[model samples]
Target chain A: MMRVAEGSYAIADAVRCCSPDVVSVYPITPQTHIVEHLSQFVANGELDCEYINVDSEFSSLSSLIGASAAGARTYTSTTSQGLALMFEVLYNASGMRLPIVMTTVNRALSAPLSIWNDQQDSFGVRDSGWIQLYAENVQEVMDLTPQLYRISEDPEILTPSMVCMDGYILTHVYEPVEFLDPELVKEILPPFSPVNVLDPEDPKTFGAFADPSWFTEFRYLQYKAQERALDLIGKVDKQFEETFGRGYGGLIDTYRTDDAEILLVSLGSIVGTIKDAVDELRKEGIKVGLVKIRSYRPFPVETLKEALKDASVVAVIEKDVSVGYQSALLTDIKGALYNTSIRVPISGFAAGLGGRDVAMKQIRKIVENASRVKDEGLELETEFEIFDVNPECL
Target chain B: MQESLFAPGHRACAGCGMPIVIKLVLDAAGPNTIVASSTGCLEVTSTPFPESSWKVPWIHSLFENPASVASGIEIAFKKFGRTDINLLVIAGDGSTFDIGIGSISGMFDRGHNITYICYDNEAYMNTGVQRSGSTPIYASTTTTPIGTQSPGNLVRKKDMPAIAVAHGASYVATASIAYPVDLRRKVKRSLEIKGPAYIQINAPCITGWSYADGDTIEQAKLVVETCICPLYEYVDGELVGVKKVRNKRPVEDYLKTQGRYKHLFRAEGGDVYIANIQAIADRNAEKFGLLD
Candidate 1:
């Protein structure tokens, strides 16, 4: 049924439809409504799982790690410091190869402790070995919730995953989202039977100590599973689209880059605004296109190369900065093009941190600067530029 | 051969009472048990590679999340509709009394069907005798060494078994490796209950406590006898079982055996510290009816 619903409630309903056997939750801003709705569902007999209200995000993820190990489909939601508090168990979940799905409402990490939106929290633990997926809208949030489970629980890809959505932009916004039929979700998603579980009938050890001899191999196996997930993600998304009537453009969603002179790259909710700016630029006869990256961890290097092959300059627009250098997404995008046949100049513009509005003017400036850099053969002094920096504050 | 869930080929330190308590608890738990261990001595020593001494299912994750992980396993079994297997957690004092308390409290608060056994060695033994929250008052550790300006650790030891009971654990017990029959009976009784149960075993550390090579059992007995670490059980918020000490001794008997407390006897104004330590034992004796 398609109805106007808040993104959090929509996601909660989508998760309930997936029928997770265990839902562990610790409330944090922009992420609370998702779990709140899920808890109510469990309370009212709409969902039939053990709903645990944990004391902290640490325990929330830790319990999920345990539940996943024991062969249960588990889900949780958190943002910003909540995700930061869960940092250690994040690695444990993936290292143990438990296919727990988490909805990470993207928000900025704190020293000043802002409850605003940014990709910093999700990007901070990029190397924790979980598959990362960014959503551009509420519909994507609802659609991708079940697909994430399929990809994470796939025998070839038994790794934990985080479905990242811009905190308030997608998490709190109301939109009409069409949920896939519950019958279809059950038909498509199989019952979780883990390859290794804590079964006393057939006892086996999990997360056991490995010496120098076997330690590297364990990590290597985790890495290999991720490498294999690159293909599995595309297959799962395609399967989801075939089962339902919608498809997110595999790993990276490209917007009219066939013969563009400039490409603006972004992820999460800002991708929607960037797409709007791209349309306005195209109507003005400017050859500007947008590429929305959906999967960030198993970064779509080949697909990105093929998508941006014809662009003369690519401008990366994102929400997180690596403190002293280019944004994390920009760095990965540049690395994706390194030593390849594609030789287009790529630059980054970081904006919309701490929930600051990413104005269309800032995105247009990115396109205009990249176009000028290509036309006049000029090189940027810095690796990437900070978009919309207030010189008055400096 | 006796039915054993924990094998003997692992590399725990000689005279380390933790492994003995672990073996006894697991034996009582039986082969139909799954263990979630925190990162500490037992985890490091038992599974040191492709080799593991655990005869049943076991998992070792971070230090502060054994109870949370065990809670997950317990809930997972319920989700799978299987109630036959026993869910057990084994963690050190650092994990139990300090870092893992919040998680343990959460596990108990949620009322999961699992038994958590904390092998209390007082200090962080695996990390080379660092002072932890469970380290006794005025006891010396590497981080709380006796010096001219220092009087060892300043804080009192956390009463973990009471903490479990306060968190509404259905069964909470304090046991010692010195009394194997009592420890085994406590473990069996905890497993018999169908909710969160906590059993804290005062397992003495030979290296950390600077004790004799074979005095682990002796020291465990002395602490219980002195009421410094009383052996008692709580069932549904009521203290029903108490291991009454027929020959209660002064706290000096237990303190004299540990080198960590040696400074309290030899230093200037040391008797004050000794009296303060005895006061702690006196309070426990009064509270648990140990002297009677």
Candidate 2:
């Protein structure tokens, strides 16, 4: 049934459908409403799970590590500084192969401190051996919830996943979300059957210290599992679509990319505005299209190459920057296209950072610049420009 | 001979008190137990990949997270209806008294049915004898070594047991490796009592304390006998048990045996520092009524 609900409630309701055995929670803004709703569910006896109210984000993820190792399906959610606090535990969770799922309500990192919609937090932890999935809207966030659990808990792909939704933009926004039936969710995500666990019947050592001789192999195994998840992510999304009748294009979803001369690549909710800009540009006889990246981590390199292969130029737009270098997505895309047959001039644009609005007009200017690069045959800018910067501030 | 849960093929220092504490704690917890260990000498020595000394299920997460991890395991077990299995956390002094204090406090305050045992080696022995919150006053550590202008560690040990009690732990105790019976009894008792329980065992580090490998037990006994490290128990916030120090020895006898305190006897005005340490013992004796 469809219900008009806040994004946080919808995400919480989606989690309720999965019926995790343990939910460790610590509150941070944008992520607070999700956990609060989960707590209320537990209090009302609607969700039959152990609700652990932990002291800090560090403990929240730490407890989930233990809970998952003990053969419990576990979850937690946080954003920005909270996610930064959980940096160590994130690597630990994936290294232990615990299959814990978390919702990273994406927000900007601190220093000037803004609790606004941005992907900087999750992007900071992109290499922590987790499968990262980005959602463009409230409905997509709700839909990706069960898929994350299914993909993370797969027998071959026992990796943790971060289902990232733009903080406040998706978490605080109200939308009509189609809640998945708990029965159907069970069909897609069966009961968690762990391969190894803390059990008296069968004793096993977990998180053992690795010596120099064997440390590389341990990391290699984690790498191999993550590589395997690239295929499993798409397979599971296909399964999710068969059950729920809604499937996000497994890794990279394309809109009017076929036979397009220019492609705008981006992730998260900003893809919504970029798509609108693509439509406006197309009406004026400019063949601009949007390539929405749903999964950033096992970074759909092959699929991305295919999507951008036909375009004359590609514009990589994102909400985060590497500060000294360019945007993370632009860097990754540049690396992905390099040495491959897909030779196209790629322009990197840093937009919507720290929750600065990335309106359609700004996206149009990005495309207009890319159009100029294509028309003039200029070299791709090595550094990304802040898309909507006010020159007066400088 | 009965088979021990904590096997003997690990790489602990010859005279280390940590393995003894681990063996005793696991032995008391028996076969039906799950252990969460923090990063410390005990964890590194016990489980070096492809070979583990543990016979029962064991997990070692990060340094400051065993209490929180054990809390998760305890609740997970509860959800599985396997409350019969004892959930235990074993960490070191550095992990307990300093970096891990917040996580431990959270575990106790939340009231999970888990027994947390800190094998107190007094310093961060795993990282080359650095000073920790549990390091004794005026005791020389790498970070607090004797210098022209310095006098070892300046501050006293943090009162972790009292802090545990303040967190509303159902059972809180202080034990020593010299008395295996007392240490094992506390572990078993903590497991027996429901809700959160904490026991800090004074496991003397032969290397960190700069004592002879053969004198690990002797050092353990002397610290308690001098009233410097008292053995006591609190049941539900009440002082129910105290190991009285009969024929109490002076602090100088204990301090003279370890190189960590040898500087106290050599430095100018060192007698004043020794007098101050003796005053700590006197306070502990008076507070816990340790005198026979």
lDDT of each: 0.89, 0.91
How much does each candidate deviate from the true structure in C-alpha RMSD?
1.5, 1.1
Model 2 root-mean-square deviation: 1.1
Candidate 1 CAPRI level: high
Q: Per-residue lDDT tens digits of candidate 1, residues B138-218?
A: 999999999999889999998778788888899999998888888989999998988999998998999999888888899
Q: For every candidate, how close is chain A to the native chain A in TM-score? A: 0.98, 0.98
**lDDT tens digits by residue: candidate 1, A240-346:** 88888889988988887877888888999998888889889999999988899999988888998888888888888889989977789988888888868898888
What's the TM-score of every candidate structure? 0.97, 0.99
Encode model 2's per-residue lDDT on A1-394: one tens digit a residue. 9989999999999999989999999999979999999999999999999999999999999999999999999999999999999999999999999899999999999978998888899999999999999999988888888888998998888999989999999998888889889999988898999989999899999999999999899789988888888898888889889998998889879998877898999999999988888888889999989999998988988898888988888889999988988889999999999979887888888889899999988888888888887776545442368678788987
Superposition TM-score, candidate 1 onto the true structure: 0.97
Q: Which residue pairs in model 1 clash with each other? A: none
DockQ of each candidate relative to the true complex: 0.81, 0.87
Report residue B283 deviation for candidate 1 (angstroms).
Answer: 2.6
lDDT of 2 by residue, B4-43 (tens): 9999889999998888888888878899999999998988
